[model samples]
Target: MIILASASPRRQELLSLICDDFSVEPADIDETIENEIELEKMPEYLAVKKAKHIQGNKHFDDIVIGCDTGVFLDGIMLGKPSSESNAAEMLRNLSGRKHKVITGCALLYKDRCISFSQTTEVEFFELTDMEIEDYIATGEPMDKAGAYGIQGKGTALVKGIVGDFYNVVGLPVAMLNKKLKEIISNAEKKL
Candidate 1:
């Protein structure tokens, strides 16, 4: 069985494009970014951690997938907003600036584990305070990293993007499908 260690509806929707049969078993683990982890690698580290937490010897024969995403601007990582004000601050900081959206993914099957991250450069149009306030009121940015959802109403805030569009939505479907196919092919060869 394929098990996805996430409860995100967006992730679930994306993963369905790669695999038809799978189960959602959101991993329960501390997501705090450790100081030891480099800013660029934090997402991958968290993804691996979450996947390992869910594997735990119980899903030895199953393919377990975990993912984590973060938005980086000016060398700092912007995670999910804690409140509306925080979201507004993030939007203001991102106004007319370019940032990166990185999604780290992990796939585990028995002793084999594969992990990777995809980065997308996104540029936001110069935003006014009123625009930021209006977007925040939509409530879409509250639960999203970088205080914006590229796939939702927040699209109006972006000027351009250079990379996998799906990555910004929280998953890199093409890369993930490729990695999953490779793992499944190798597993079949061994059998």
Candidate 2:
């Protein structure tokens, strides 16, 4: 069995593609970035924190997976927009520019763990204020990192992506599928 330490529908849906024996238990770890940590390392830090937080109080021995996703433009992290206005601002900042979407994942099974992060470069076409406002009105950016969901209404805001599309959607399926296979195969050896 596997346990996903997040309530994100995107993550839940992604993990579902791999296994049906997992349960959702969103971790309550503080997501604030450390003052001294580099921007590029924040995602990995949060992923590990979330995984360990849930792993520490385990009442069962199922494998646990924790993940975090963030968008960075010119080194500044764009977290989930706090409001419609904030979503517009984030989209405006990303207009006609390229940003990096990074997702970090951790897999824990008892005393064993594996963690990794993947980054995808996304380019947005020049968006007018009307376009941003219109996109925001669609109500798609509220729950997504970088104020957009590549797999939904937010696709109109993106011009192109230079890396894994699934990463932008919150999970790198190709990479995650490989890791999950490894975990399951190893777990079988101990069975």
Candidate 3:
């Protein structure tokens, strides 16, 4: 059985584009970036942590997938905002600038694990304070990295992206699909 170790509806929706057969098993862990992990490596670190956290309780053959995403600019990580004001500030900083959306994905089965991170460079049109305030008022930026959801109402804010568009959405479906195929092929060979 395949399981998703996340509570994100966006991730579940995104995963559907690649595979429909899976279960949700949200992992509760300290998602804070550790001092030892570099800013660019936080997503992969957290993703593996989340998967391993879930792995302890599942069947050996049950594969669990975990993912984490963050926005990075100038080597600093932009996490989910703490309040409306914070969201506004994040949006302001991203205005008319290019930032990276990094998503780390990990798949665990038995004692084996495979993990990778994908990054998509996204640019935003210069946003006015009124526009940022209006977006925040809609309550769409409250729980998203970079205070924007490129796949939702936030799409209006984005000018363009230079990598896998799905990576900005949350998961890199193309890469995930390819990885799963490899796992399945290897499993078949073993049998």
Name the best candidate (by lDDT): 1
Instruction: Look at candidate 3 and tell me the lDDT of residue 36.
Output: 90
Tell me the number of clashing residue pairs for each predicted model: 0, 0, 0
The alpha-carbon lDDT assigned to residue 12 of candidate 2 equals 88
Tens digit of per-residue lDDT, candidate 3, span 62-139: 778889998999889999999999999999999999999999999887778899999999999999999999999989
Candidate 2 — number of clashing residue pairs? 0
Question: Each prediction's Cα lDDT score?
Answer: 0.95, 0.88, 0.90
Q: Who is ahead in lDDT, 1 or 3?
A: 1
C-alpha displacement of 178 in model 1, angstroms?
Answer: 0.6
What overall lDDT, based on C-alpha atoms, would model 3 receive against the true structure?
0.90
Per-candidate TM vs. native? 0.98, 0.94, 0.96
Off by over 4 Å in 1: none
Better of 1 and 3 by TM-score: 1
- What is the alpha-carbon RMSD of candidate 1 to the true structure? 0.9
Ranking by TM-score: 1, 3, 2
Cα lDDT of model 1 by residue, 1-191, tens digit: 89999999999999999899999999999998788999989999999999998899488898899999999999999999999999999999999999999999999998899999999999999999999999999999999999999999999999999999999999999999999998898888889
